[model samples]
Target chain A: MSDIFERIREKFPEYFRSSHSNFGDDTILIKPEGLLPVMGYLKDEEGFNVLMDLTCVDYYGEEERFEVVYHLYDLTEKKRLRVKVRLREEEPVVESLSHMWKNANWYEREVWDMFGVKFLNHPNLKRILMYEEFEGHPLRKDYPLRKRQPRVGPLN
Target chain B: MGVKRVVTGVFGEEGFITTKLDSMVGWARKYSLFVYPFVTACCGMEYMSVSCAHYDLDRFGAALPRFSPRQADLLMVVGTISHKIAPVLLRVYEQMTEPKWVIAFGTCTCTGGFYDNYATVQGIDTILPVDVYIPGCPPRPETVLDGIMKLQEKIQNSKQEY
Candidate 1:
C-alpha cells in the first residue's frame, strides 16, 4: 500500500471500491460518479499531472460490462497510478477527463470508437481510429473478428 | 535491338524495321514506367530498400516515385489497405491516366496477408485490376525487382490501349 493510495482511499472512502497492487502497479477501482472529483484531486493536489493513457476494456458477459481505465503519472514524485471505472452494459458512460488534459479528447474519441464507451462532456466525441461510417465497436469481445462491413468503393 | 536484328537478317542490311503500332507502344511503355508508391505500413521499409541505390529500381525505369496519381503510369500499393483507406486508394487509382498498371507490392496488398478482420480490406484486387502481385509480408528488394521485371514482360506482351 503506497502513501498516495492510502491518502486517496481516506479522502474518498464512499466512492472507493476495491483496490489492488499487482507487481508494484497501484490500481484503484472507483465508481463512475467519483471519476471527476478523484481525478481532479489527484491532478491538483497529489501531483498526478500526466494522464498517460485513457482506454476501455469490454468484459462481454460480466455484470459490469465495460471498464474505462485511466493511467495517471506524477512527474515530480516519479509515480504512476491506475484508475478504473466499471460501467453496466446498458449505458456505459463516464466523466470526460478532456477538460483536465488536452490529449484526453482524442483518447476518449478512440475509446468511444473502439469500445463504445461514452465519455460525458467530451467536446468532440467521434471516431478517431475507425472511419465515420464504421458501425459497431470493433474492440468489444462480442464483435465478430472476421465480420466486415459494406465496402466503400466499386466491387470490380 | 531484337526487332532491328530480325529486320537486318531478313533484308541483309540494317536500315528499317516494320512492326505493329501496338508492339511499338508496348515496348516504349515498358521501358519508362512512372511509379506511384501508395505506401502505408511496414512494407514501406522494404519499398525504400528496393528504390534506393543498393537495390536500384532505376534499372527497371521505376526509381522515381511520382507523388501525384495523375502523373504516374504505375500504381504500386505497398502495404495493408484498411477499409477506411480503400476508398482513398480507389480514388488514387481512378485518378491515374489511361494505359496505367497496378502492382500489389506485398502480401497484404495482394491477399490481405494475415489481417483477416473487420478493419482490413481483404485484398486490393476487389477494387482495382492488378497487373502484378509481389507476395511477401514485406517483400525483399530482390523479390520486388523480379516483380518489376515480370510487369515489364507483361507490358511487352499485352496489347497497348492507345
Candidate 2:
C-alpha cells in the first residue's frame, strides 16, 4: 500500500489530489465539477492513457443515490487509479471526460443511458442500449425487475 | 474432394444437404443467407468458432460477417446486452437493410438467464423483433449453426408467404 502510494506521489504529482483512502482499494474522491481538468492532466502529463472502464453504482439504500466511477490505467507504468464522484438523486451532473479518451464516448453514453448521470460535455449522450421510449432509468432501485409498462398506441 | 461436392456445399444443393444442415433450414432456404453477429460476451467466442474454419458456416453462405448493417440480412444478438448496450443493439437492427431477421443467440441475450438479478433485460425480444430464439447457457457452435439454419428457414418461409 505504501509502495503504490509513493509511486503515485513520485511519478505524477500534478494529477494527484488530496483524499487518498484505503477503502478496499486505492480509491480517491475528486470534485465532481473538476473531473475534466483532473482527467486531462492524467491523460496529458501521466502515461495513464486508457480509460478502461466507466460505470456508476446506485447506492440506493444510503443517502448518496449514485457513485460514478472511472478506472484509468497507465499502460507504461502498469498502474491503475479509480476516480469516483458521488451524486445526489436529483440534480446529478458531472463534467464529461470525452475529450481525453475516445473510449469514454461509448462508456459515458452507457452510464448516461443506464444510470442517468448527465455528462455535461459528452458529444452524444443519448440512450445507447435502450429504446428512446423506455419510461425510466431501469438501473435505479425504484424500477421493477420485470417492468410491465403496457404498449400504448402504434408501434413506431 | 470434387468440384460437384464443393458446388453443392457452396451454393447448397437440394438433395446434397447434411443431416444437421437439413434440420437447420428447409431444402431451399439454406442458400444465399448473410449473418451479422451482434456479439458482446463469451457466447461471441462460440459464434466466432461456428463462423471460422472449424465449424465452417461458409458451407451455408453465413461465414462472412458483414460490418455494414446495410449488407446484412440477419442479426445474431450473441451475448449479455446490458441496459446500456441494448439501445445500440436496437440501432444496429434498425440500421440493417430491411427483410432482416434476428436470432436471440444465447440464454443471456434471449433472456437475462442467471442475470435475472439486476439491471439486465429478461429477454432481448422485449426490445427488438426476434425471429428465432436459440437457448443454451452459452450455446455450442453446433447449436448456433442450428439457430442460423432455423432463421434461414423462417426467412425462406416468410418470403414464400409474400
Candidate 3:
C-alpha cells in the first residue's frame, strides 16, 4: 500500500532525481534550486501530507553552515519520509513551502530564527522563541550562550 | 434568645475547642492548598503520577487544584518555559492571588540545562517570583514526590499563616 517513491522511480525516473551522495532510501539531499519542485511533487503526487517536524543540524567547522532536516508523514500509507537540504554559511536561500502546508508557517519561522536560513517566499517569518529585541541566533554554534534576564525585576 | 444563650453557655468554650480540634473539622486549618499545575513539556507526566492514584495527594489534604487564578494558592510550574512563552507565563503567575508560591520543576525550568539555544528560557525564576526550585531534567517520580514533601515542610514552617 505504501511504497509510492518506488513507483515514481519505475515510471517517472527523470522526475525523481538520483542523489547518491550522502543520501538514504527515504532521505534525499537536494540542491537549494531544486527544493521547491521536488517538494511540490512529493506533496501533490506522493501522499506525504503531514509536515511533522522541520529542524537543522550545524556542522560548525564545515564550509557549508547547516544541514536542514524536513520530516514529512503520509497518513494514508502510514509511511514517513525525511528530506535534507544543505546550504552554504553565507547566502543560504531555499524556496519556502508555506504555500504547501499551514504547519510550515511556524516550522519555517523556527528554522529562520535558529539557523538563520533564508526562505525566499516565507510570509511573516519571524522568531517564534526569542524576543524581537534579541540580537543573535542562539541555535547557531557561533553565537555565545549567555542568559538574559529582564531588567525590570530581580531574579526569581 | 435567653434559653439559647443558656444552652450555648452549657456547651462551653472547652467543647468548642475540642470540636474544632477533631481531624475531620478543618475550620481552624482551612488554608489547605490549591496547586496550579504549571506543566510545560515532559515532567508533567511524572507529576500526574503523584497527583493520581499511585501517590494519593488527597491523603495529605493538598491534592485539589483550582483552575481559576483567584482561587489557587500555589503555582507548580512543572516544565520548561521558553522565552516566547515567558510573558504569558508571567501573566498567569500574576493572575494568581497574594500569598502564592512558585515551584520551578525540572532542570530546564530551574536552570535551562544543555539547551543553550535561542528559544529556550534559561531559568523561569528570571521572569517570575519563584519560591521553591526543584532540580531535575524532567525530574523522576521520586524526586517530584520529594519536591512536594519539601513544599509541605515549607507550608508548615511558614510564619505568615493563611
Candidate 4:
C-alpha cells in the first residue's frame, strides 16, 4: 500500500498537493482541475473499484472554502484511499464522478443539496434531500439554524 | 321485539348497564381505533415492537393497522417528519375520515428530537393537530401503549359532532 502510494505520488506530482498514510489509511489531496483525471487513474489503473462515499465539508470564512471528499475502496486488493479536492468560496464546482461510479450520482446530489457545491455535467443536478423551493444551503456556516423556508400551506 | 324484551328485562334488573347513545358510540369508537402507522425513521422499530405480541397493541383494540389513510381512524405519525416529507404526511392526515385522531409517536414526531436542522420539521403539530405525544427518543413499547391509552381516553371524552 505504501509502495503504491509512493508510486502514485511520483506519477502525478502536478496533481497532488500533499499525500500521507496515517490512521491506517492513505489520503491524497488533489486540485480541483486534476480531480477527474486523478479519480479516473485510480479507478482504471490503480483498481479502486468502489466509490464508497462522496461528501463535502464547509470551511466557512476561508479563501478555499469547501472540501469535497471521496472515499474509494479497492475490493480485490482490500485497500482504501481518501481523495480530497478544495474549492473556492465563490464557485465551488467540481467534475461529477457519476460517469465513473454510478452511486456517485446520489452522493453528489446529497453533497450539493447540503453544501450548495455544484457538480458539473451531472445527469440530474437537483436537490435530492431538500425541496426545490428551499433557500440557502443549510449546511453552509452562514445559514442560520432558526431560519425556515416554508413551501407548504398552513392547515386551516 | 324479542331484543327489546331482553333489554327491558336487563334494564329492569338493579345496577344493570345504563348510558347515553353518544357515550355508547364514543365507547365503541374509543376501543375500535384503526391506526395508520406512518412509520419513517428509527422510531418505526419501536412501533413494530409495540404492535407485536408481548407488547400486544391489539389488547387496546387498536390492533388493526390500516395502510390506506381512508380506512384509518387514527394516524400514528411515528419517527421524524422532514420538511420535504411534511406535505406527504399532511396529505395522508387529510385523507383520513372525519372523527380522526393523531398520536405523535416518539420525540422526533412530537418535537423533532435532536435533529434541529433545516430538513427536519420542528414538530408535526405545526401541520396536524396531534392528540397524544408519546415522548421519548424512540419510546419504549410500554410508553407507546400508555400513549394509546391516553388517546383512547381522549376519544372517549370527544363530542360526537358527526
Candidate 5:
C-alpha cells in the first residue's frame, strides 16, 4: 500500500502535495486540478473501485476554507483510501467525478449544498438536503447560526 | 304557570337523557379522530411501536393513520422537522380540514432536541399551531397514549369549529 503511495507521488510529483498514514490507514492530499486523474488512477490501477462516501469540512479563517474528502473502497482487497482536495474560500470549484462513479452525482450535490462548493460539469447541481430558496450554506463556519430563511407559501 | 307546568311534564321523557348539541358533537369528534402520521426520523420507530399491536393506538380511537391530509383530523408529527421540511409540514397541515389538531410527537418535533443549528427548525409551533406536545427523544408508548388522552380531553370540550 505504501508502495502505491510512493509510486503515485513519483508519477505525479506536482499533483501529489502530501500524504500521511496513521494506523495503516492512508490519506492522500492532492491538488484540485489533479482530483480526477488521481481518482482515476486509484480506481483503475489501485483497485479502489467503490466511491464509499464524499463529504466536506470547513476550516474557518483559512486561505483554502473547504476540504472535500472522498472515501474509496476496494471490494476484493478490502482496503480503504482517503483522498482530499482543498478549495479557496471565495469560489470553490472542482471537477465532478460523476462520470467515473454514478453515485458521485448526489454526493457532490450534498457537498455543494452544505459547503457551497461548485462542481464543474455536474449534471444536476442542486441542493439535496436544504431547499433551493435556502439563503446560505449552513455548514460554512461564517454562516450565522441563528439565521433562518423562511419561505412563504400557499401550503397546497 | 299551570299551562307551562303541564307542557313540561308531557315533553320531558323519563327514559331520554338531555345534553347540549355541542357536547354531543365534541364527544363524537373525540372518539372518531382520524390521525395522519407525519413521521420523518428516528422517532418514527417508536411511533411504530405506539401504533402496533403491543401498544395499539386504536384503543384511544385514533387507529388509522390516513395518508391523505384531507382525510385526517389529527396530525401526529412524529420526528425532527428541519427548515427544509417545515414548508411541507405546513402544506400538509393546511390541507387538513377544519377542526383539525396537531400533536408534536417527539422531543425533536417539540424542541429540536440537540440540533440547535440552522438546518433544524427549533420547534414546529413556529409554523403550525400545536395542540399537544409529547416531549421525549422518542417518547415511550405509554407517554404517547397519555398525550392522546390529553388531546381527547381537549377535543371533548372544544367547540365544533366545522
Candidate 6:
C-alpha cells in the first residue's frame, strides 16, 4: 500500500472496511456514511481534485445488491482511487457529491436514471438519458433486454 | 416525353395538349422534390456521400436539403429513431406541408436495424407513413440513389393532394 492509502486508513479507521490493489489500481470499500467526509478529505487534504466517474453495479440476488462506485484522480500526483459503497437493494441511497465536484450533478443523475440509486441531496435527480414518459429503468439486471414501451404517436 | 408525344400526335400539331391534372401535378412534384434530412446517427455519413458531387443527388432533383420541415416535400429519416426522439420526429412530420412523403433512409429507420431494445423504436413507419425503405446498415451511395429513384417513381404515380 502507498503512503497516501496508509494516511487515509489511519485518518478514518472506523469508516475503513477493506481495500485491494489489483493491476496497479487501488480500490477502497468504505461505509456509505463515510462517502461525503472521505471524499472531502481526499479533495482538501489528499489532493484527489478530480472526480472522474461515478456509477453503480447491480449484483442481483445478493444481500447488498447495489454497489455505488466512484473513481477519483489526483492531478498533481497523477494517481487514481476507486471508492465503493454497498447498499441494500430495498434502499439504494447515497450522499450526493455535487457540492464538492460540480460534475457530480449529472453523474448522480445518470446513476439515478440507469441504476435507480437515489442521491439524497442531488439538485435535480431526474432521468438524464431517457425520456420523461419512459416507465422503468432499463439498465437493471431484471429489465428484459427487448422489452419495449408504448410509442409516442397515434400509429402506436 | 411519352405522354406529351401521344397527346401531340392525337391533337395533330395543336399548340396545347390536354391531360389529367393529377398526372401533370405528379410529374412536376416528382421532378422538384425538396427533401428534409432528419439525420440522427452514423447513416448521416452515408447521406452526405449520396448528396455530395460524387454520387450527385442533384440529378434526381433531391439535392436540395431544407433544414426546416415547412418547405420540404420529402422527409428522409436517416438514422435510428430512439423513443426519446420519436415525438420530435412525429412533430417534424406533422409540421411539414401537405403532399409530403417519407423515406426511411437506412435499416435503422426502416426496421430499427439490430437495436431491438427498450430505447430504439422498432421502425419509423409505426409513427409516420413511409413511402420508400432503403435497406442497408448504412446504405451505399448507389443504394441510396436507387431508393431516391424509387421514391421518384412513387411520387410520379401517387395522386396529388393539390
Which residue runs does candidate 3 get wrong by more than 4 Å?
A1-18, A21-30, A41-54, A59-86, A101-103, A147-156, B1-31, B113-123, B136-153
Off by over 4 Å in 4: A153-156, B1-17
lDDT of 6 by residue, A21-111 (tens): 9988999999999988899998998889999999999999998999999999999999899999999989999999999999999999998
lDDT of 5 by residue, B60-144 (tens): 8898989999999999998988877788999999999988999999999998889887778778887889999999888999999
Ranked by TM-score, the better of candidates 1 and 5 is 1
Instruction: Please give the lDDT score at residue A119 for candidate 5.
Output: 98
TM-score each candidate.
0.94, 0.55, 0.69, 0.91, 0.90, 0.91
Q: Would you list the C-alpha lDDT of every candidate in the order shown?
A: 0.89, 0.74, 0.72, 0.87, 0.88, 0.88
| Tens digit of per-residue lDDT, candidate 3, span B91-155 | 88899987777888888888777775555677887777777788876677678767767766665
Screening candidate 1 with a backbone cut-off below 3 angstroms (N, C-alpha, C), the clashing residue pairs are none
lDDT string for model 4 (A3-37, tens) is 77677678788887887888878898888999888
Q: What residue runs in model 2 are displaced by over 4 Å at the alpha carbon?
A: A1-24, A148-156, B1-135, B138-162
Model 3 deviation from the true structure expressed as Cα RMSD, one decimal place: 6.8
Cα-based lDDT at residue A45, candidate 6: 89
Top-lDDT candidate index: 1
lDDT of 6 by residue, B18-52 (tens): 67788888878887889999999999999999999
DockQ of each: 0.56, 0.12, 0.29, 0.45, 0.34, 0.53
Candidate achieving higher DockQ, 2 or 4: 4
Q: What's the lDDT for residue A97 in model 2?
A: 82
Top-TM-score candidate index: 1
Give Cα distance to truth, residue B71, candidate 5, Å. 1.4
The true-versus-predicted C-alpha distance at residue B41 of model 6, in Å, is: 1.2
Chain B alone vs. reference chain B, TM-score for every model: 0.91, 0.78, 0.77, 0.90, 0.89, 0.91
Which 10-residue span in candidate 2 chain A carries the lowest summed lDDT? Answer: A147-156
Model 1, A94-115: lDDT tens digits are 8898999999999999999999
Distance from true location, Cα of B87 in model 4, Å: 1.1
For this target, which candidate reaches the highest DockQ against the unseen true structure?
Answer: 1
In candidate 4, which residue pairs get closer than 3 Å at backbone N, Cα or C atoms, i.e. clash?
none
